[model samples]
Target: MSPPRQPLPHRGRGAVSSPHARFEPLAREGFDDGWDIAEEAPPLATDVAMEAARSIISRNDSPDIGFDRSINPYRGCEHGCVYCFARPTHAYLGLSPGLDFETKLFAKPNAAELLTRELSAPGYVPQAIALGANTDPYQPIERRLRITREVLEVLSKSGHPVGIVTKGAMVTRDLDLLGPMGRAGTAKVAVSVTTLDPVLARRMEPRASAPRKRLEAIRALSEAGVPVLVLAAPLIPGINDHELEAILEAAHAAGAREAGYVVLRLPHELKEIVRDWLVEYYPGKAERVFAILREMRGGRDYDAAFGTRLTGTGPYATLTARRFETALRRLGMARRGGLRLRTDLFVPPVRGAPGQLSLF
Candidate 1:
């Protein structure tokens, strides 16, 4: 049976409210739509927070990724990328992975304070901390939230090195902070540009900054002396695959010093969301897209094995990698070898009242 489609709610233009739609778990009669173009109606969210004692880090053991520690100031991204792997995480909070992941958002208002405490801890280690590994640090709510900026202030004050991945041009607002970090070797930024086609980008990453704006962001970050990395992440075959070379060339010309790519990964609820998106927007190409993805993923929708998941297996995957590598080589850009971050610089905060002297 086809999944029922409901009208997704919009918080009006430029409101920046969480726009994810909820999936009604049980069968109901009124919600049938052939394409499953569900409109996720959700109330505008007010900030809810948790007091974090030490929020500076999270350790990861996934061999597929390079970084060991990461910091996310928010939960539930507003960008609403249908292919996002982080969507499943919302389920743990008793939220529907479908719309709740995007509509009902959470903010870590104390992230900056906790980060400062963590940085000052006695045994704290400082490898390059990753920002936006899960939820985008610079999502639209950030304009008012300012949590991400607060955390950056903590990192900058401590002289800690950090790496960031984001799709928002809002990062430009922090040029004052990032430029100094870049000069001091304390910061680097990578902007993910999935496709240059505005139409495709609009449908796929409904709320993300437009493609041209992202290239402009690359230019701005580069001009500010920040080492910029261009990421053509989660490349969807038969969807935006044809834009690969063009995107790389555009980003390189726009001053991206390094480049990388990840094939589309549809893990958990994302499979249904992305499938629904395709059927709605590209009805004729949906089957072919899924077919190519399956072929690349060893005949499954997705293979979660660390090594094979990020980059798929089989002939089609190999060709995609080859294409990316050739583009990188021609542009005089490296394949983004492991970036070793400084961990020895971490200093744990003194444990005592604000002004109390600690005798160690």
Candidate 2:
């Protein structure tokens, strides 16, 4: 006989056709691992909700961050990095922090329209707007959604300075728009490389572009004269932390002139999900990893203090920072070199009169 089904958590979407809904849930006690043993469900019809956002620029005052205003074209990320800090955000939408965060995504279809209007506002001040801050702009759904590309087009046409960070090679497809903007000093790109070890990367990030592919994307962007920054983000301790020096070396060889890294941050539901993933994939080393994380996080799973959130607090975290800094210095990699897009260079596109400028 099959195991009894566990009650499905309310996702607030009114029960739909979910493949996992029919499967008899495995007993909670049977598995030796911590991951929820629910099977993959059938894909849902992706619905694009046109959010008529009052504004597009997100302002932040965090001292550690590089930019002030950022824009995210989509809500949930399909790449499904088990350690994403943004995963907890889906809870505010009344969605499950588990599968729903990865599967049920929301795209801002009106992002470009809203952004254009905002940029043309009476007192709009030009600043380098960041793309893919919360969730990747080039997630797999972007191929069909095209919301990110639309936003890029708006920025390009308006001569607005834009900085992008993504792990998707799909970004290369937008070089036609980005290259010109780059030459005009209005654009720069950052390609994040998590790990060169394919096996670890596959299990950690799942659907994100492979590490090698990300390097190729950096090379491609650099060749096109679009400055590329290599981002070695979310460096999980005792997991893929050993690759620090190697990641920098590889990125430098790929023509990356700048590099940056963030210590792994597990906020709220992300702690549970990432821990579950660790137990499932590296059962034996799971304990060691968690122990190291606790050491870095002041004996907790994570620390969210403003100055210490992105980079952890304790000795281990400090050591990791030192190691990364040493490598960057040796490689002559400056943190802010690749993306120096000039906001002073912005010139708004002229909106011509409907029928008057046709032959003029």
Candidate 3:
């Protein structure tokens, strides 16, 4: 039999436990024995492995999402947002969606090469390829791997439109490539700032850029001519929801021309993950937070219906939407990705030629 698993201590991580995968037939938990025999576990460190994916493009026909296709340069985000809807994807790899979702990361070293091949396919269609849709393309590992940068190089050479969504301030490092493309109307970026409270941000998203840094990233991207949109994503009620207008205002003052928001989503193991986190960090408000979320999510932890997935249904949801729209009007920010990136500029790379030839 497998050994019992104890709840992991918080070590600058969002998840305090590595729960059993839902697919596992048996579950294990550590309990305190009268002897107090268990020793404190050491802090968790991140582990990244290369994934040789057959394809880099992920196509989705969901009506709620804006893009038809997207690319994720990495998997299992290190930012470790407790409310991340993408965390459950770790289960597909036989890993726990708790700590495993953040500590066990994957880098797609060949992503650029694969993207080039796919974009050059005979029947390939040109459109804005979304980045950071599932996992953040600018996660900390990206600084060393440079996989996301390589992918951007390929897209820039072909004049392909690419839209990026991230909470990492490091995205500004690629402005040299994004600048010219933005000038050509072929690049855009969305910066999601969940709260202006640094303490809350640290506990909720342990490694993501601070709220101020994200706003600065928005300003930098906009100044470089890239269309910048601000996202008050996963806006937790009784937590950051009260700062909705303030977040939009800060983003607008930083030069963002668009804004959007998604209520907190607790899908799959996320429900348990977030519940535990709330009890640990905001014990006093945890019940009320869940109560408000349930009210917005049709009296459940989450609602996956197409139309209501991104924007929930009910009175609170309606009020949130109304407030968002009103804030946009006051700030003169569009309630979308702002400008359409130009797909007509795409220059397909010659399939069998040297990579350098594509730049011309």
Model 3 TM-score is: 0.94
In model 1, which runs have C-alpha deviations exceeding 4 angstroms? 1-56, 338-360
Task: Provide TM-scores for the models.
Answer: 0.86, 0.85, 0.94
Candidate that would win on lDDT? 3
Query: lDDT tens string, model 3, 1-360?
Result: 444444445566888667688887778776655544445668789999999988999999998888999999898999998899999999888899999999999888889889989999888889999988998888889899999999999999999999999999999999999999889988899999999999999998999999989988988998999888888898888888999999999999999888899988888999898888887777898899989889878889898989898878889999999999999888788988557889899988665567455443
Which tens-of-lDDT digit does each residue in 19-55 have in candidate 2? 2211234322332344456664344444455566767
Candidate 3: clashing residue pairs, number:
0
lDDT, model 3, position 134: 96
Candidate 1 vs 3: which has more lDDT: 3
Better of 1 and 2 by lDDT: 1
Per-residue error (Å), model 2, residue 21 = 18
Models sorted by TM-score, best on top: 3, 1, 2
